[model samples]
Target: MRLTGPAGLATRAVLAAAISGMVLAGSFAIVAVMAVAGGMILSAYGSDLLGFVRITPPQMFWPIVWLLCALGATGLFVRAIVRIIRTERAAFLERTTPLSETTMAETSYIDSSAERLARQVGIATPTVRIDSTATPLAYTTYRPDTSIINADRDETPVIVLSTGLIETLSQSELSAVLAHEIGHIANDDLRLISVLLMPLIAAETLTEDEGRTSNVFELCGHHLSFIALIGVGIFSRGRELAADRAAAVMTGEPAALAGALETLDESATPKPTADLRDHARSTNAINVLPTLGPANSGTGPRSTHPSLETRLEQLRSLARG
Candidate 1:
């Protein structure tokens, strides 16, 4: 397979998978602990569980408190899992125009770019899509593998571009953006980000209404989500830079991407592509640019992407090389 970046897409994807596994497991463990703790605490007071091992005052007190925490965490974990299984979609998504339904207006410009770039990357052309929104946006989202397994059972990735993006960028610059997104598919980034984001989504959903009333176990799960978020952020930035390199190498036009990044940030009136209340973290993880403002955007280690200047410099370096 063709390598996409310094360590190659396979290697980077492996790292992201490993991190995702850890995050998933860690969050579950916290919930399991919460369950155990909660059971022990409940048993201590009035329940019959563990009443056989009648440990004395102070020692029993600490154990009881710990047990309650574990019990609560476990409950939250189960609820989250159930919700995920039932809902299927990890998070709410904005509507996107699918390939068959895509209008002819800008199809020539966007689809042709995607078709050409996918060929260069040796991947099947993805379903290029448009989101009917005013905000400039670009992101890759996963499609579930529902059809009977064939030799080509690969879940087709979707590249979504906002109306504002199409209106704002020149064809070359938009092509660069398309190349960058196609690079994500070439590098297996869509699945990686989706897997890495599970815990964060679970945490947010778990605490959506809890507010101050959230218990220690819930808090633990929330805190563990941060670790997952950080992991996602680091790998996300790596993939972003790698995709930049891939775009430049594939298109032989790093300046085009650099210019697109500049124009997106320098927009006279920047509109958010995702609701900060519900979807900012989700969108920011995979969007071309972090939809949230800088405070919570992918500008830092805690967010999903690197700074605009960082990405621009990467393309500049690629161009120079």
Candidate 2:
């Protein structure tokens, strides 16, 4: 009923390649046409309007321009991914303090538990951190290890648990939460998420949808954003399910995770304000629990994670097995 393993990987790969190819071809065509037309226009009026700046097509302009653009875009995309990870972590750190091993012995225990869970899920121990947020949430992020530069040093992912979450769940439930986060690290979902966001980032740059923009640009961005959002939703939902399965297998306690989820599910209240709703939508992709009012309530492209009911069903199935 669900796509997992090699079949799912192949499906996602094909879809991602198709979408990326379409976007690249469209961008290249647009840029090439604009460049050629601009050159022609300048050449036509240069003598009369502006004599100082000579406008002429460079030798092998098409190849040179396209090659440069391809390389620049690739480099920028990679850099953007790194910066995004750092920036998000910085923002979260700004709002809260790190967990102190000396003062908080309980958190220290949780940290050790997280390390064991990470190994169980087949990943290096992720750096464990804590946030002061009252919301019961846990999430993970990762970057490549740079200790040896060229060598792969088993980059540790980061696992963050809110203080509220720690206070809320029992020890077994906390272990389940850690297992779920370790599932994300083991899956390399942070990289997958960055890949899914690239098109939306490109769209935002072209259209400036976050700020005021011309009507035409706004319209173009709307369409592009919609497409990107749909892609993200589909891709992310699968990841959540995969992580749930991994957590279940690693902990051999899908029931514990299910109970933890149900406990958190009780905390879901109707988001009354626009800002709250927007925040929920934005974080849903990363958070262990979706914050968009209720799970499976919204339809279509807006839903980032699958419904709690759906996730619980999966967990229950694993537990039964």
Candidate 3:
């Protein structure tokens, strides 16, 4: 589902809850185990002062203590494993494939066009990078640079486009795509999404374990993480539509932006099974639902982009005006 507007906000809230819940649960488990171990140690050592104290054998005492400690450590480790798994899954879901280095040169040809468009929109020129990926994708990154735009010298924006996108779109549509990515930079949407997702990413990294079994608790955690990731995915889709709108406004060519969306929609072909659709929905940037044919289709609440038809209709409306 699209992650913009009210829906996006709700999804972010869910993601926050998932991350917080994992951390809290892990900590509580560790504390409980430690408390139990401490009590056992005291009893074995005859430290009770109520009335009568009983002492245990040295061999038994040492082994029990060791076992308690081992158990506590094991619990903590398992919690960490769960957290890491969730985080990785979230990151994977959000990751947009970078354009390949091979196609960077060709995609870089649009840099001049992007610069001109930025000027028209009253934003400073952003550094543009091109990737060689076959997927028609684009994203922007910000870096601290000693460059002045309207006397601000803190953060500079960099826009990256995929060569596949460049090859797929006509010149007018390419400008619209560039404008859309530039809109992301202008609105600082990229930074917001990154910050919101950092905790979940950290949690996933902490809980990852290669050899650990997927126990009931871990499996439940994974499902929560997956839901949270879906929320993030929804948020991302909304941002995409917003960017499209921004692109249309900046270029004053709604049809061009609409065309670009249609191109992307067409490229996202479906695989064979429902399982693959779920996998693609979770893992792929492009949604592969059957209804979205090359011409037009309605995007549901969960879509990252508006329906191709909806976007085209909006463009046509703008063009008519």
lDDT for predicted candidate 3 compared with the true structure: 0.54
Instruction: Give lDDT per model, in order.
Output: 0.70, 0.64, 0.54
Q: What's the best-to-worst order under lDDT?
A: 1, 2, 3
Q: Which candidate should be chosen as best, given TM-score against the real structure?
A: 1
Q: lDDT per residue, candidate 1, 1-321, as tens digits?
A: 353576554565577667767877777786676567566656556433345466344557656666667766767666666565234343333466664576646778787889998998788888877777667788877543322112133667678888778888888899999998988888776656666677776666555454443676567556756677777776787888888888888889999999998898776245553434445446767778877666545455676777777888788887898
Specify the poorest-scoring 10-residue window by lDDT in model 3. Answer: 144-153
Steric clashes per prediction: 13, 0, 20
Superior candidate under lDDT, 1 versus 2: 1
Candidate 3 lDDT, 1-321, residue by residue in tens? 121333454555456445545654654465467656765776655544522545434656655765676577667755654454344344333333333334444445476787787776567787665544455555565432212112243355666565556787888888887888777666656555544343334334333452343664444344444444444445555555666667777888988887777776676564224333232222233322222233223344334345556557766877887
lDDT of predicted model 1: 0.70
Residue by residue across 19-83, what tens digits does model 2's lDDT show? 64465455445445555555555555644454456545555654555566556655665565456
| Better model by TM-score: candidate 2 vs candidate 3 | 2
Indicate which candidate wins on lDDT: 1
